[model samples]
Target: MSEAVLRLSGLEKSYNRGKPNEVRVLRGVELALVPGEIVALVAPSGAGKSTLLHMAGLLDVPDAGTVEIGGREMGGLGDRARTAVRRREVGFVYQFHHLLPEFTALENITLPQLADGATERAAQARARELLSRVGLEARADHRPAALSGGEQQRVAFCRALANGPRILLADEPTGNLDPATADRLFDVLMELVADEGLSALIATHNLELAARMSRVLRLDGGALHPQA
Candidate 1:
């Protein structure tokens, strides 16, 4: 069934408060991502794409509006509840691969599972499976410092999928890589998303990447609208 896994309505956020320097970043944003969807969000710089992404990932709360994940509204959830929801439902990827330097590739992928109290064996198995999918099984024991930029990003992808997150939010995940590398990374990302039946909302500046998604939505004047 087509159901909204991640949804936002009437979202708004502003920096500074009741002062001459105050500026509204997002003005009444609304969007949704269904299960198995790969949607692209495009916007010019300073159009509040990052801010909206932060709010959707549950890293920050909007000054107004509500964000719901897996049918649970986060508007009234307390900090403890929000953290739990974030850990259980949302996965995030940034432009820079944020793999822990000290952790082996396997360990990095399994860290979130460990945090959620999964047994070592179970987490290892999951990590191994993901590494195989990302074609990084041989790098399992290597540290981030020992891997190339593309390899590091592959590990990051594995880590993000460790918990079987319902929604994966990728903010310019390939923005740091060269064209060929970025293309390969996106291929791996889309493969995993399909294989796991995971939903995704990726914010990007690359029109070619955006065009390949199921739908492309442009954020303009504080709102999201489908782009041709």
Candidate 2:
């Protein structure tokens, strides 16, 4: 079997540590995602789904255990090194479309590539290509405010993939859309992931959507279990 593209081993995280009101968000969670696999993460609200995604994407540190991306241990990496690895290997989407209102769809998608050292022309070309793939080429010049919710989220998807990251960690990517829109957008998301050959861990409450992925895991009581 191919090596896992993203692995979380024995992860543990807590809030307000050592305090009377401390809350444990994760406990000994282990996960591994091989290339080109799309895994659905199902969890109740406030079940630490976001926290798990953060750890997987290197946005947060675990109190215990390690995150390995592309076989590199991330626990001991400095902030700069972690950031570099995250920029080059991880992509993230949230429950809401967080596109910058001031930037056009194309510009928003181009910004991350620029930050990663790509030239402006190259970033723009890549942005256009992704937009085209999602059928948003004509809306590239529009800002988030000018686009519908579904369109805005689609642009957000393109922006997330702009850097060609190996792993995509999404927290309720279509939670805000209506049923029909959510279903359609999810189809686009799966297509994009397949085209990019990425491994994805997407959190959602929609069972129908979860059933479409390659595997399903339930996040309950701060740990992961295979969905029966």
Candidate 3:
């Protein structure tokens, strides 16, 4: 069996603390993703799917519990250390493509690699390779505005992969696309995940998409429940 790449234990997060409108987003939520395993995170609207991904991705700290990646505990890590872990080990994809409008698709993917200290030549090579994998090579020089919604998201996927993260955390990655486009893009995503042997936790409302994953976990009322 593959080693666990991501693990969350007894995670808890709350907002508006000490106030009447306070919201408890995640309570004791636990999950683990093995290397090369693709797991689905299913939850309804406002159910803290984003919160869970953020916590798992190390973008935000949990009020309680632990977030671990590659067996390294995240709690108590300094900001620079946590950021280093995030940049080196995790990749994030959101509902929105969130590509830089002014940059070409190739540039968007190359930028992360550059930030990670790759040489300009090496970064561009990796960017071109990933863009080709997503069938976006032809659109490499186009800006986000010039691409279709599906193409933009495909570029986002390439950008996420440029850093070669071991784990991918996606929050409703295809939520903005039409049914046909979402399905196609998801297939590409699954292929990339399998090819790279990266573990992934993707949140989605679509049951069909959820079923395609290796395991499905539903988040409701701040807890995670496995589904048949």
Candidate 4:
């Protein structure tokens, strides 16, 4: 069996601690993602799905428990170390494409690789390859403003994978697309994930999409539970 690429154990988080308006988010949540597995995170709004993802992706820390990637614990790491580990081990995709309007699709993808120490030529080559995989090779030179919503998201996907991360954490990646566009982009996303043998934890409200993943974990009542 594939080893766990992500492990979240006994995690706890809250806002406005010790205040009347405080809201407790995660409550001792635990989750594990094995290599090459794609897991869906299903949760209603205000259930802290994004909060959990933020902790997992190292963008934020929980009040208690641990976040580990590839067997390395992340709780006490300093900012620079955490940033380095996150950059090397995790890729994040949000609901919005968030591509830079000034850069071409290929450049948007290439920039991440370059930031991660890849040579310019290598970055460009990888960008082209990823764009081709998503059927965006012909749109490589077009900026985000010139592309359709689906196309922009495809570029975002390419950018996420540019650094060869071991795990992907996506927050409603296809939420803004129309049903047909969402379906098509989802197929492309899964294909890319499978081809790379990477583990993914994706948040989505679409039950149909959730059902297609390797497994689904629903976040409710401040905890994670297997859905069927």
Candidate 5:
């Protein structure tokens, strides 16, 4: 097996711990994603898919477990340190495109670099290269409003890759698109994972998409389960 780029061991998360209305969102969940592997996290609604993704992506903390990326455990890290780790090692994609309305596609894609203190010029160059890689070179200067849903999503995919994150946590990346568009966008996503050698854990309800990944894991009953 490959060395893991991301690992979750004995992971647990809960809301309102030890009080009335306490609910465990994830329990004893264990998963690992190695470099260049794309795995699917599938489950029905209310099965804690998003909650688990949040913890895995470092957006939320686990109540009683550990999340490790690049060999660093996040269980005891402070908020600032965790944010830095996420910025350097993880990229996240949401269902919504979430592109900045005020910026062009290239600018929106490069925004993360500025947050990390990179020069605008350097970021722009990387962003444009990504745009080209996604076949969006001509759309670089267009605003999100001028793009189709699929185009906007393609830009978002490029944006997620902007920082060269070791792992990506994508939540329903193609959920909002039409079936045809969804398949196209999913292809772009998988191609990038293969071509760039990045690992990914993508949460989805699409079984066909899940089947296309290196492995398919179903999140059920607040735990990670491998599908046969």
Candidate 6:
């Protein structure tokens, strides 16, 4: 079998480690995403879904256990190494678009590629290509405020994919949109992942949308359980 693109084993995380109000977010949480797989992570509010995504994307660290991307262990890597891996190998989308208010859609997408060492011309070209893929080529010059909610989220998706990362981790990516818009955006997200052959772990509260993914897993009581 092909190796897993992203894996988590025995992950444990707690806030306020030694305090009475401490909260344990993840307890021995584990997951594996193979190439081209789309996994839906279903969890209720305050269930640590965002925390899990952060750990997977290297935005945060687990108190115990390991995060492996493309078979390389991340727990012991230095800051620079972890940052480099995050830039080149992982992509993340949150509930909010979080686009820079000043930059145009195209610019927003181009910036990450530039940060990853691509030339200006290459970055712009890549940005244009991604916008076109999402059928937003004409809105490339529009700022986030100028676009509709759905459009802004679509642009955010393009931004996450700008670096062509192998793994995509999204936290309620379409949650802010209306149901109709959410459905449409989710379709685009799935298409984008498939076209890029990316392994994705998308956390969402919508069961109808979850049913469309390759597999579904539930996060409850700080652990992961495969959905039947």
**TM-score for each predicted model, relative to the true structure:** 0.98, 0.99, 0.98, 0.98, 0.97, 0.98
Candidate 1 wrong stretches, greater than 4 Å: none
lDDT of 1 by residue, 1-228 (tens): 777999999999999968999888888898988988999999998898889999998999999999989888998989999988888788889888899999999999999999988999999999999999999998899999999999998898888889989999998999999999999999999999999999999999989989999999999988888997
* Per-residue lDDT of candidate 3, residues 125-228 (tens digit): 99999999999999999999999999999999989988999999998999999999999999999999998889999999999999999999999899999986
Pairs of colliding residues, candidate 3: none
Residues 1-228 of candidate 2 have per-residue lDDT tens digits of 999999999999999999999999999999999999999999999999999999999999999999999998999999999999999999998879999999999999999999999999999999999999999999999999999999999999999999999999999999999999999999999999999999999999999999999999999999999999
| Tens digits of per-residue lDDT for model 6, 1-228 | 889999999999999999999999999999989999999999889999999999999999999999999999999999999999999999989899999999999999999999999999999999999999999999999999999999999999999999999999999999999999999999999999999999999999999999999999999999999988
lDDT (Cα, 0-100) at 146 in candidate 2 = 95
Of models 1 and 5, which has the larger TM-score? 1
TM-score of 5: 0.97
User: What TM value does model 2 have?
Assistant: 0.99
User: Against the unseen true structure, what C-alpha lDDT does each candidate score?
Assistant: 0.91, 0.96, 0.93, 0.94, 0.90, 0.96
> Which pairs clash in model 6?
none
lDDT by residue (70-107, candidate 5, tens digit) is: 88878888889989988988888889999999999999
Q: What is model 1's C-alpha RMSD?
A: 0.9
Report the poorest 10 consecutive residues by lDDT, candidate 3. Answer: 1-10
- What global local distance difference test value does model 1 have? 0.91
Q: Indicate the worst ten consecutive residues by lDDT in candidate 5.
A: 62-71
Question: lDDT per residue, candidate 4, 1-228, as tens digits?
Answer: 766899999999999999999899999999889999999999998899999999999999999999989988998899999988888889999999999999999999999888889999999999999999999999999999999999999999989998999999999999999999999999999999999889999999999999999999999989999997
Q: What shift in Å separates residue 60 of candidate 3 from its native position after superposition?
A: 0.5
